[model samples]
Target: MDKISRLRGFRDIWKDELEKLRKIEEVARKYLNLLGFDELKVPILEKTELFVRSIGETTDIVQKEMFTFHDPSGDSVTLRPEATAGVVRAYIEASLFATQRITKLFTIGSMFRHERPQKGRFREFNQIDVEVFGSKGPLIDAELLWLISLILDELKVKNFEIEVNTVGCWECRKKFKEVFLSYIEKKLDHLCEDCKTRARRNPLRIFDCKKDECLFLTKDSPLLFENLCEECKIHFNKFLNYLIKFEVKVKHNERLVRGLDYYTKTVFEVKSSALGAQNAFIAGGRYDGLVKEMGGPDVPGIGFAIGLERLSLIVNTGNPKENLTVFIAFVDDKAREHLFRLVKQFVKSNIRVFYDPDSKSLKSQMRYAHALNADYAIIVGEEEIKNNIVSLRNMKTGEQKSYPNDLEYLIKDISYTK
Candidate 1:
């Protein structure tokens, strides 16, 4: 029979990689907490309509990438392609909008999508999502950007640029989309099929198109800044002023339309030169109308999400943690019984211990101990068991010491050594 193979675009995050991911998550959680954003968790599954309503009917996520299935009860369910929609749903369902004045939330989890996976994109990937509700101003936008800055700095990811934009409120967007699409429509035939389709349903998305010809066609297309309404212009300018005040570096990118339909203004993405053409490692923006759309009162919100897998790749430490802290090796079956009891005692005391069941030779056991990178190799032989003592060998230093069967004392010594 052929060997069973893992699925493409999805692979096991083995111990070493998981350790790196854990470190990244820990740092992210600490940073978010320090910023006064409480941790929040939203389920991976959500009603299909939640995404359709928030992400928009025209986007690829809803039309193509979503993993939608019908439940046995004849209801439509979807593996959330992103977290923001489910987050908005939670805010509305729990009535958090009315209860909390400034509900800042941070989430970390897997999101599913069906896109053809590549270097940074995958079928199942993790994201660190943040959402700030009930506040609207340039100061808040700057604060979020600064938070992102701190996260990237903590990870030591130095080569990243901040690209910012404002997709003005609904009133200004209607006019900008009209003018922007008209200029691009003249060159529509030059664009790819995806761009052509988006032109009709979501013209703003054309700016975000990755197709070679589509990118070229949108090179000189009218910018969204020129068509901003008085209110949008004021809000965007104030945001720029705040960015200057906070000393956050930002580049005006008219093309930064954060994909989601709910985004009203202040969209931004952190791009890295290390990741070639697909440079975004983190992206987010303001969604002032999402609350109202999700059946809550009108509330403005903004937040960002960092791609965990991509961040892990860029921030890998290359060191794998050892499985066992101490290995209990016995010389004979008689010694094994005593060692087994000692192993149980160590386990009960929360010590990381391992042992080979087979009565192997002393040489083989030592080899296994070295292979496992055990800190201490506790040797229990007939002689040692007779005296109610064990010989502890430090694998790295080739030092040895005899200790009584009191596992607690042994563990304390090992902890100090570590």
Candidate 2:
């Protein structure tokens, strides 16, 4: 018989890789808590309409990537490809807006998308998502960038760049779309099939294309920033100024329209050169109309999601070290009985211990301890039992000592030595 293997585009996380992921999550939680953001956990499965409505019907995630299907009840459901939609649904269903003037939330979990998996891209991926609702000011936008920078800095991620852009509001986009459409129409023949479809359905998305031909043709296209309305221009300028005031350095990219349809006015991405073509480890923008679109009251939102897989590729978590490791070695049946008691005591005291439950010989047990890189070995036998003392050997120094059999004394001595 053949053994079953993990599905493609998925991976088993363990050992050092898992440790690094945990460290990154820990740092994210620490900063989010300090910034007064509460954690919110949402289900991975959501109604298919939730995404089709929020992420946009013409977006790639809805058209091609979503893992959507009908369940036993015959209602369309999907494994969430992103989090904002689900978060918004929760906010409305829970009537959170009725009580709080402003709400800030952060969530850490897995998202599913059926796209071609690459170095940092996966069908099943993890993200640290943060969202702020109610305020439409540029201050929160700048502050979110600062928070992202703080997290990356704490994780020792170096040489990353923050890129910013403004897609403007719907009214500004309405005017820009006309001019953008004309420019794209002239070069539609030279663009890829996907870009051509985008040109017809959502011309702004052409700027998100990665093909050299599409990029070359759109490089000279009209700039959305230059065409921004008076209101959008003022908001964008304030956003840039706020970033400067916060001492958060950012590069303005006129063509940096993110792939999401809900984005309006401000958009940003954190890029790392080390990650190559898929360099963006963090990306998000304001979705001022999404709340109302999701059947909630008119509210504004700004948020970002950090791809842990891409982040882990660049972050150095260093060697994971155990605080202390102990091994219990016993010689005879009586000594084995004592080992069991000592093991329980050590565990209760929050110590890591290793022992053979099958009553292996003292030599065999000590060898196992050495293999496990134990810090110390506690040897017990009839002699020590009669003497009412236990033998403690420093595995590193090859030195030995005897302490009273009392669990308190042994625990204290081990801790003090450590």
TM-score leader: 2
lDDT of 2 by residue, 159-265 (tens): 79999999999999989999989877877899999988888888887888888999899888898889999988988899999888889999998888877889999
- Best candidate, lDDT-wise? 2
lDDT for each candidate structure: 0.85, 0.91
> Per-residue lDDT tens digits of candidate 1, residues 1-418?
9999976677789877889889888888888899898888889888899999988887779999998999999999999999888887887888886678989888889989898888888899999999999998768988999888787778787778899999999988998888987798678888898888888888888888877788887777778888898888999999989888878888998777877788888999998877765578899999888888877888898888889888776785657654448888989887877865788888876668878878799889999988888888999988897888899999889999999887667777887765
The positional error of residue 161 in candidate 1, measured at the CA in angstroms, is 0.9
